[model samples]
Target: MKPKCGIVYNGHLQSDKFMVQLHWLSDTAKRHGFEPELIGNHRLIPAVIDGRCTLLGPYADYRPDFFFFWDKDIRLARHLEKMGFRLFNSASSIEICDDKSRTYEVLAEHGVTMPKTVTGPLLYEGFELEDVSSVPSIVAELGLPLVLKEAYGSFGEQVYLIASEEELIGRLKSLGAKPYVLQELVASSYGRDVRINVVGGEAAAAMLRRSETDFRANVTAGGRMFPYEPTDEEKAFAVRCAELVGADFAGVDLLFGPDGEPVLCEINSNAHFKNIFDCTGVDLAEAMFRYIRSVLYAADGSRKGDAPC
Candidate 1:
């Protein structure tokens, strides 16, 4: 009997992009001899963790052979993990990678090159911006054209490039005390960066992102994709980032620092692959499915209840 697999996503199936990826994942699972099912918000998703009315609905009250949280968010993954679901990428990894500042900290701790970062408290909590007296020193250290980002933001939504002190203060005031991070801007990567998809601690594919009009290079924000070949150093860094966060699959973004070294910018636990797939013929969904299946098979054989072959 084929193992039952659930592909979960937070968006509605009506979304074209989401549907495409879901189909790809389902197809890959079926090809690998698994009973793959696409479970979205409108339908019931088995093996889900209870108490969350997410796009995948509530848990089906029974354990599945395999549960894929897809891009449904880290919180759901954490809840499911607590409910005894075998997740491909654990909730801890998702949570760490989802926050840019945390991702930076993890990479830096592992000796990976990354921009200097300082996280601030939330604006709504009455955290005074005046408390950050070292702003000037930080600017002096990192120089002009620094990047400011919210703690939890995606798709280039909450990123800013402040070139002057006035601009920095104005932007901070506008943020209204929301938690944020300041980092040295990699001017060379102005609207450009490399995104590498790693599976099982190996670089599966890479693509260069370029946005001529915006400082953010997210494809969803009008960035163009170009095929990129990862250098030995880049490959090593990608692997390290994935392993550091304990991600079974990940998208590692790398930018060039002022010293011309490849530095980790961020890692995505549930990275979208259509852009990279369009640029490079790497089918990430298929690769991920194969890796997950291999792991499940190995784990099954290791269980005490399993018969010795």
Candidate 2:
């Protein structure tokens, strides 16, 4: 019997890029002899909770063998995992990766080399100088032209380069101090970084994201993507970062520190693959399916072995 796969994606198929990813996954599944079902955003929650059922829009309900969370939204993963769905990159991993502050903590715990960073409440909400005093210390230790970021931001949004103390304080006050992270900026980056895609504990592909005009190097932020091959040390660092967070698959961003060492920047659980696929010709969705199949098959075999025969 062909295994049924359910892919949970934002229902807005209006974007040509999103539609292309969906088509690629569907085609790959068909080629692999699996029944492919695309579950839009509306029906995703109920379908996962109901188990082995299908849902039509907001009404129908269905369960699937495996659930693929395609969006950066972390809440979906949390809800589905609670309902006992087999999910890639698990909910806890998603939550940790989604919050920049938490990501730093986890990476640090694993003894990964990363930029000197300070994470706390948003600037607008008002942080006590005493409570967040370490932020200034990091600045003084690492030197000026630092990066200030929101705890939950994507596509290079809400990230700022602070060149002076006034600019740093002003930006913090403007943001209302909700929750943010301040880090030592890597000036040599020239608004560029390496994004490595890892699956099943291996590095699939890597690309250099460069934006000479802006401080952010996200492709959507007017950056360019070029093929990149990480050195052995770089590759090992990327893989270890992903493993530290327990992600089934991940996109690890790395930057060069002052000492010219590869430092962890951030990790994305539900990484965008359109740009990566365009640059590397690696069909991640297909690779993901194959990996999932292997895991499920192994588990089934283990169950049979344990059964009283």
Best by lDDT: 1
Task: Give the TM-score of each candidate.
Answer: 0.86, 0.84
- Over the stretch 49-126, how does candidate 2's per-residue lDDT look in tens digits? 346433345524455666767665566666666656677768788888989999998888677988788776544334
Instruction: Give the 10-residue window scoring lowest on summed lDDT in candidate 1.
Output: 300-309
Give me the candidate number with maximum TM-score. Answer: 1
Model 1 TM-score, all chains together: 0.86
Q: Give Cα-based local distance difference scores for all models.
A: 0.78, 0.77
lDDT of 1 by residue, 200-306 (tens): 87899999999999988998889999999989988998898899998999999999766657887888898888878999999998899878766767655332333
